[model samples]
Target: MAVESYKKIETYKASDVKTKVVDTDVLIIGGGMSGCGAAYEAAYWAKAANKKVVLVEKAAIERSGAVAHGLSAINCYLGLSGRSQFTNNKPITLEEFARYVTLDMMGVSREDLVVDYARNVDDSVHLFEKWGLPIWKDENGKYVREGRWQIMINGESYKPIVAEAAKKAIGEENIYERVFITHLLLDKDDKNKVAGAVGFSVRDPIFYVFKAKAVIIATGGATGLFRPKSTGEGMGRIWYAVFNTGSGYSMAIEAGAHTTQMEHRFIPTRFKDGYGPVGAWFLLFKSRATNAYGKDYTENVAAIEKYKPYANASPVPTPLRNHQMIEEIVQGRGPIYMRTEEALQKLSAGDPKNAKKLLEDAWEDFLDMTIDQALLWAATNTEPDKAPS
Candidate 1:
């Protein structure tokens, strides 16, 4: 695929999507690292065994799934040094890694065991190599060790690369992009084996029924449903996609299919506490995070006098104890989360004096950026009751 190929496939607003029914075998939902890995494995393996494969993704297989953006890593492997510093003679085996992970891991740890990650150690290296990544060892005959057994390579390829490859191996006619899987069509007779699936396009929400001997659901994960402290879609503009909102799980549940590791994999995403769609996107481009009180968060950090403000703001949002603010508003101390429309209107009707100051204050935070005069339009309005103590 060339750079021009993707530009040709416009991610037109879903409202513009045109969907139709299709057929396929094996549908795997979730197009993140695991999802793409599953697709690459299934498609290529089936191709190796001479089988037909169709992978359905809610979003363009790239930029939406976990692996779509820029993430070139496979930390699920074990180290022979095992100590993480490259102990040349101490080659770690699957059993050793598994025993360490499962045994010492107490409450909840995503760390892999030796046996589990063992096979993947070399297998993953091979997988990268297969994907055209030139992985190599260090001059000392160990994985190019840096901060630890953390081998750094030219591996910044996104998960979309695999989808790009699968799109080729599986043939364009066989692949359908932007198709959402809403339900698993169970084989009426067997009930256990899935014969096909049904879905619609978010663009139109029309019913798209697909039938096949074996159906796969590649619908990714549920994210963007809430604002995260980091890069969450709090308003559904999630890090993943809006379509990943429980559709796959809903389909599986409706079909009565049981899932394993649900208990373990049921961890909430990190960095979603203070995230909002408009705030998250704009902050990355220019502005920085702020407390509900409209305080400059970066300035607070810079005043700490302890650490050199690690640049402008802490690389990550600092979780502050804004109890007085939240309590005053939420518990009727100051303002409330359920601010009435009237209150918002009043906050917006601020005097020109403070309005310009607020926008200028925010503008002063980020380097080399400007907040349009229009952004301060809302500042003129009355704010929701301030968080009171």
Candidate 2:
């Protein structure tokens, strides 16, 4: 199909074009979480200074980027006081969070960046909540804990909520939907500064040339660079948004931005056929991941210093944990199962849906979170049956 399309495009010329121009003070490329956040933040400041802010996304901002399906967990947050706390309680300190992150990464993290993120992460989550995101709470009216640094949330409409907020801040007219940015434009006076960008509409052949004083590139990561475990019928069925092809990274590299950590890539361990996250079950309901030998491998390695900090925490580092799990599999211990028996039993004693009732109320959230796998479960008539995964 690609070959046929290329053959037809052999006679196509760059000169056959229609042009549209947009002038703004700040232009944001990519309508993902970061991009939308930047747009709204810029608009917040721009409103006081009477400046224009524009955002262009390859896809619709309402359903684009990594969190398009929404996230059940806010992984990096201050314990419970920051935003979720309704009283005048002090939140976790920036230094404490930074130290925790450094320890988690085995002393190989940027302290300054971690501190900054820790300081602001809760506010971001709170903003989403203000815009109509629902955080799960317990019987005592406290926010439910997914892990030490994570919280459960009803975030199926996360993208749309943020997108709507960004639209309100910057004005809906300033947003360009379905615009595939090909490259960045450098300023004539100083090459160090970005002038604007050029792109084409994904739905049409119209060409676009945007001119702005400053540009923010916030497209998410690339996934197709490495071969996925699920191949053949389910080639692009792994975690991370498949639509996120790392175009922003490529554009930044081409624009001569100093890049780091290119060699460090995380290998996520997912379910066998469906490829959905198994960590959530463990984190949310105290589920255990056992191997073919019916032993929890993570418990055996809890004494290791590198994993000690997260020995009690759910959702440990994927790269390291996955390594340990793989080693166990290679050493004749395969077929790991994410067992949620205790939670299932408690739920089944009264609730027929079991712990899945949390999902049943927000079924769209579940479907969006696990697009293919949830569908696969439905198609196969699979039930939780005390062992959800």
Which candidate achieves the best lDDT against the true structure? 2
Residue 183 shift from truth in candidate 1, angstroms:
0.5
Q: How many backbone clashes does candidate 2 have?
A: 0
185-278, model 2: which lDDT tens digit per residue? Answer: 9899998888999999876668999999988998888886777656697787777788988889888888777787665455577777767665
TM-score, cand. 1 vs. native: 0.55
Instruction: Report the number of the highest-TM-score candidate.
Output: 2
Clash pairs, candidate 2, are none
Considering summed lDDT, which 10 consecutive residues are worst modelled in model 1?
Answer: 365-374
Worst 10 residues of 2 by lDDT: 80-89
> TM-score of each candidate?
0.55, 0.85
Off by over 4 Å in 1: 1-19, 48-50, 79-89, 103-118, 134-137, 140-142, 146-150, 204-206, 224-243, 265-389
Model 2 stretches with alpha carbons more than 4 Å out: 1-13, 79-91, 261-264, 299-317, 346-365
C-alpha lDDT score of every prediction, in listed order? 0.48, 0.74
